[model samples]
Target chain A: MSRESVVGTAEHAAESEWGRLSSRLILVNLAILVAPVVMFLADLAITGDAGLQALITLGSLFVTFLVVSGIGLMRLFTTRYRVTEHSVELHSGLLFRSRRSIPVDRIRSVDLTANPVHRLFGLTTLSIGTGEQSTSASHRLALDGISKADAVELRRRLIEARDARRGYAVPVEDDGPISELDWSWLRYGPLSVWGVGGVLIAGASVYRTLHELKVDPLKWGFVKDLEHRFGSVPLWYGILASVVVLVVLGIAGSTATFIESWSGYRLTREEGGMFRVRRGLLVTRSVSIEQQRLRGVELVEPIPLRWARAAKLNAVASGLGSLDDNRKRRMLTPPVPRAEARRVAAEVLGTDRSLVLRTGLTRHPRAALRRRVNRALMWTVLITAVPVGLGLWLGPGLVRGGLIGGAVLLLVLVAFAVDAYRTLGHGMRGRYLLTSSGTFAHRTVALRQEGIIGWKITRTPFQRRAGLFTLGATTAAGEGVYKVHDVTDAQGIALAEQAVPRLLLPFLERDPRSAARG
Target chain B: MEDVRLRPPRHRVESRAVNWWRLQSLLFAVPLPLTFGILWASIPPTRQIFMWLTLGFLVPGLIYVLVMPPWRYRVHRWEVTDEAVYAASGWLWQQWRVVPLSRVQTVDTLRGPLQQIFKLSGVTVTTASASGAVKIKGIDHAMADDLVAHLTRFTQATPEDAT
Candidate 1:
């Protein structure tokens, strides 16, 4: 009999139970249910009120964990799934009774994730994303805490089922390592601006967590005996020591996150035009992108990364929703050299195409440079005037200090403005618009002009005086709008008209010389 | 698409839009200045500074309520073609947008309770642009309907291009 015939004959067909280890995995959730009681115990300890009340509280906490664990265990026993030729069915919920089925063809990606706990237990949580950007949380079906063997088997069956339904084995061919973990890139890892702040925040939270448990953090992890011991050292020495220690901690934290997220990062071009990036050490993440969904790529270079000549490659894929709060920017490559980033961008966008991301950009008019400089000077004066004005009003001591500080600040501002002006470039090559702009962390995006849905022209009173306008090419792809600010009015209009041809040309009043340049 | 004209639009909105905008200006102006006066009146140290700045602000605003409405009406222009919708607004700091009909996600007609009293309407064309919606206010009711119908039909006729 055919597969359909066999499924039809069976009763509730091919229902299978996950491994018994899933019950043990569910026990971890008991801690959440009993956390309040634990906090109460900590409070009692701190207050020195450890009597019958403390014993009773501890007993109640134990009972709560027991009951929660029992419910979690019950859930695992009740859950069952059926994999048919057409659909994958899941049934759970003891009292409410919920059933969900995903059609084989609708499955976009099957990803496996595991935390440190799950890794120790040899378990995996499989998530099936339908590639839907809906607000509904049910867009992904997650099978929580299954045996490694069963999870692997289920993943294979689901993929094979999908393949059988569609009739082809998507090549899982090895593409011979696109990128490898190297210490050279590690230097850029800690160079992110967020690192120091992230480390400090994380450290404060950890200290708070320990404090809540009535555990002294100074004794717990941070340098011990520094509580009152810091007073013995000279103030400057203490401050300097702490600064050095904090910087070391920040760099360490940055490297840890970098390794945790992109340690085993590999980008492989699979069969049937699907590319997958599998990385992370303790908590693994596997992101897959279809060739058809990819509109373009973005080179993200933070100020420090830029100075180091390194950039991270992020994909501009359609219908791709972001995942995780951090570490989930849909990146294609780790922090690599600028040359390699350009090469990879070309490769991702396809070298087969006439348009490449590494095209020479056209510089905007001299007026744009002047406008940037003007803006910088205006900001400098506004910032400096506040202190200097207060200095004049308050006393003469502040006047001397204010002038010296203001002059230094003005010089820095001028340098940044000149750099920003130098960075201003816009080019249209083939079907792409290659635009570059930024004072510090410069980004050069090669966006497809066809992806642009609209155009916005902005001209302030000052800009109008300078004959400058900001042209934003609005697309659905990367970060939405790519703007070339402070371009001459004629250039802005011309860029819009040339990028989209007939669309913007209809509304714009054309000037022959600028039109030809665009 | 190639046959589209590069000519500037000649159509002006209904002349009554000037009165409506002035009314809108009044609607916006009254509460804000009154709130400012109340706030600065209650405060002690900055009362003198507030009075001067408020006058500095209110003089231009009073001029706007009386004079800038007609000036704004003179500048604001909108036009629609089979391919796209165009709008130009603002007097000093001018802004314009050409939202391709093919990229329009939604088209809406807006008539507030006050706007309805004037027998006037406004149309908003939403595209996938981060710069926000293209809103053409102070339109004739019948003209608004025509715009909505035309934009709806035009957008529907074009197949969605994948991002």
Candidate 2:
């Protein structure tokens, strides 16, 4: 029977209808497995390697493909999903048949993704997230290679069902989008550390791959000529020239990636209290997060972006996925002007003004600065000692190099320490608690005060001597713990009390003698 | 400076927890010296160095077994109130954690073989946040049960989503 006829009959016969995934999923799976084999065969044909061994290898590959495709076909036919009044259920697997039923009210997010191949086939993968902290397989459900339209319909139906269960007011009319891509934001792309880092990583991998194949770049005539040219120039000038070239290439690469990843980026607030992000050039993505799950927003400014007056925004939400996945899925906006980042953050949090961007953050005590400086000095001694000790054992030529490197390192590290101290601050504004820190990548998190579930106070021997402590406000959002480093003991207690008023009062004591009663 | 300190949590653990810790450390400590002693006797060339190693491990392990239990007893404390649970743990590097009753997700009592020998149980109070779990070890078994019951009641009373 046709898929539609089967679904229609099930709907008429039962309270919920079982729907199959797109049959084209089998073709897509086979194509993914076959493409590489075809390329390998083409390469063999070009090299005229039609030996008996080659024929045997090709036969085995064909057999493997058939076995894999058989499994894929069975999976495609067996998988089915159905939505009832109170829950959504999925039944799948061949030898290890399994069933999953998730309550409608527990569903937290519905995300749609399609790579270039899937998009070419008009298919998308839908993942249903319940926001459980456990990473067990049963907690995750993904429908692979469904028709894009069907995926969208399923996502909407699931969300609507959840909203209905929660007794939410009916969804209102769509209000355009909250934010959209601004091409000018691409200017900040080249200012990110990733611009240079990405180039280095890609270049290293390509070189390594060639080396693995016994190809040497140094043996090439053009590379030898370039080396000769560099040899003739002064050492510092040659280094400068190479750095300039690397930067130019890095900028071009980052700008291209920025365009490809965020070409049609749009952030829209959907009808039923969900925020949807749609972006990507070739492999499009649509992520929908329940508005109620968002605990806060964070404004991230790497050193280079901060210097360029730019920043990015991320949502501090629960159930985005594991820590790494949460970080990737939480991106609300790519690098944008600081003002735009703040505006978007404010919009996302539904606040009048972005509290993290506000001024007059409470400065940490001077002891914090002392602690940082002490740590910086200790690191300098440890690092400098390494090279100096090596030089002493090696030769005088290395001694001069060690001295110069140590001098530069000392300057950079001391400056970094001071900047780290300066960036540290914590404050409360309205209903949100704000904590800002980090020097390499400064993050100012505006966490909802009501969302703070616990407090952790840590004191090291050094911190005890300085009368300073680190206070971590624990929540289920973002990194789970946003710490205010090197605050005085009194300040940590005061801030914790102020952030969650009555939780700590019962445990606090003003006098030591009275503390004996606990 | 005096006003800055936290009032230590209310209750000390069962005193026999010290013996449990001491036995646990001794169990770990005996292995190293024994291994080194066997090596020293079996290997001729490395005997001198191995002998020194045996002494090295044995001396410090003995000291740790003697010192750590009582020191940890003084440091580890826990108190539960109507509104929140508070705990202080660790020696040298210390931490105080406070989790509100409204945000508690689960309360579990764990008793290992050694803890059973000492009639001690450990209670773990989990909040919505992964890192916000408060663990109180070395409490009387009966006291741990009462704490778990008390916490469960408070958590159930506030049936809001902790996240």
Candidate 3:
């Protein structure tokens, strides 16, 4: 009866928004406000004339209704989105007149999320993300309040458009939905450092929020309860006790978060060569990536996870998602057994190249080992000296702690350095190049040599003096550049030559004895 | 045992590009300290410290700007081959990079105002690499065009490979 009465104008080239949604939005919002509104009305009736209060209430509501209806009208008729042959163009804003278009070829993923309110109205919010844009604009192109049918249709059309551009046979086949989150995997959640980190972050945020609100957390009911439970403890003991409590809480919080995120996880390899993942307990997320977009796979083993013989598998794809944002949907497997991860990676890639990471890893030269050792020693010295200096500056109370801490840290660093060296290996099995390295989080990458676009050879003054150079393989996929460090110049060039043959051959001199010089 | 020496690249950037870089460095280095010097001179307590700091930054900076152009000219080298484009550059430590003819997505040439004055041009070869686009600066105008033309021909001939 209201805003849907308005028809789309000629200037509105794209189709109009769905259903206005005024009835739904108003009903939901009004229902939420009803309790407070009723309380206010009762108070007004008690304080003033009942009839006048009712009249005022009706007047205000009529005004709210008019305003909401106007907005719904403008939104219904003015806002528009269209799937053109080549692009998804969205136009909104009445006065400013904004138009944004994402080319169909560039659309990497379209994720749909619908809350309870949206589900009631059969609506979904679409997040259209493109892989290659330098700005956050690529991640946040959301189309809100679209019909579920239209959303499905739009995704199909966009996929079709991409297929047309790519000249690939498109199949809508959905295959065996394998691999759900195992309750046993819950063991890995508590083992992760991310749990402790999440706890610390939550505490910091809560502390900040309390400060912003000008509320003293110490005087709060929980703190009082904690204090009562602990009794009047001494200062140092109080600190230690709180620290232990916080750590336990953090572990619990992190474990809960992991379960929530990974529960009901399912992976499906469809007939059309797309790997679709549907996961999440509270907010269900569906991600489908075509096999054509995948470049390689990475096996990441954080030190603790490694200790447990567990690893996480991530797909090295153009626009799978951002790691900085902790979008671990890119991860093929959670912290599972290393062997299990390998199997999962093999299944996901659907190729024999997945086996390349496990075997035939050629170790880097002795010079690389020396470099790591020296670097580790240098860092140990530098880091220890700071604490030593601080102890000296702050007087003698901290000297023993500083010295012990420094020694322990140095020991850890030394072990880490040796592990890093142990991890340093690269292998080439035909077109596939396998490289694995790291200290805390060892990563093994299996990439295609043909995928390499360029070679960047760099030698620091120190590296040059040591006759060593690093060769970074550049590609459009993954983190962009994968580096092989501290190799002899001959080895580096030889590696590059093998990676992309004629490209480096034209530049390298025939002689191999030339050592790098600063 | 075969011995290898640093074989110089086939083409060197225009000598004037050195001056342009120095000029560019000067453009960057001069204003901030000059503004800070004026601000420091306006206040009495900070004047000596400001003078000392400005001298500290500018003296070495001016020396660096002047010396770097020619020293950079000494090191800057590039060669465009039938198979790839190679650029050898850097200051303390050098890097020699190779971007094959097949991988280059776009070849863009820019002529900044100072570059125009120096009769120099810069070419950037953007490939589909995460390391990002490679830039070769201080080419003579004709050479830039010739390089671009050659790259265009190669790019057109092999669109099937790298992308």
Q: Per-residue lDDT tens digits of candidate 3, residues A121-157?
A: 6666677766652334434566666777877777777
lDDT order, best first, reads 2, 1, 3
Give candidate 2's whole-model lDDT.
0.82
| Model 3 chain A worst lDDT window (10 residues) | A1-10
The list of candidate 1 runs beyond 4 A from truth reads A1-25, A31-113, A117-173, A207-242, A322-327, A352-359, A511-518, B1-29, B35-76, B89-94, B127-131
Tens digit of lDDT per residue, candidate 1, span A355-468? 333345677788777777787888878887887888899998787887888789888988988888888788777667767788877777777777778877767888878767
Which run of 10 residues does model 2 chain A get worst, by summed lDDT? A1-10
Residue pairs in candidate 2 whose N, alpha carbon or C atoms collide under 3 angstroms:
none
- In order of TM-score, best first, we have 2, 3, 1
Error of 2 at A73 (Å): 1.8
Error of 3 at A42 (Å): 21
Cα-based TM-score, every candidate:
0.79, 0.88, 0.80
Q: Which has the greatest DockQ?
A: 2
Q: What does candidate 1 score in Cα RMSD to the true structure?
A: 6.1
Superposed by TM-score, candidate 2 places the C-alpha of residue A201 at a distance from the truth, in angstroms, of 4.3
Write the residue-wise lDDT of candidate 3 on B11-74 in tens digits: 8888888889899889877876787678677988888888887787778778878877787788
lDDT of 2 by residue, A1-518 (tens): 12121122234545346777898877776776566466556645555555565556567768888888788788888899888667777778878776767787888889999988888889999998878654543357889888998998998899888888889855656767888998888888788677777889999987774444334567777899999988899999988987998898889888878887888999998867888999998888888877888988888999989999998889988877666667768989989998888888788788866576736899999988888888888888888888788889998867788788888888898899999988988888888888899979999998888778899989898998987888999987767788888887678778887898877777767755435655
Predicted complex 1: DockQ: 0.38
- Interface RMSD of each candidate, angstroms, one decimal: 6.0, 3.2, 3.6
Better of 2 and 3 by lDDT: 2
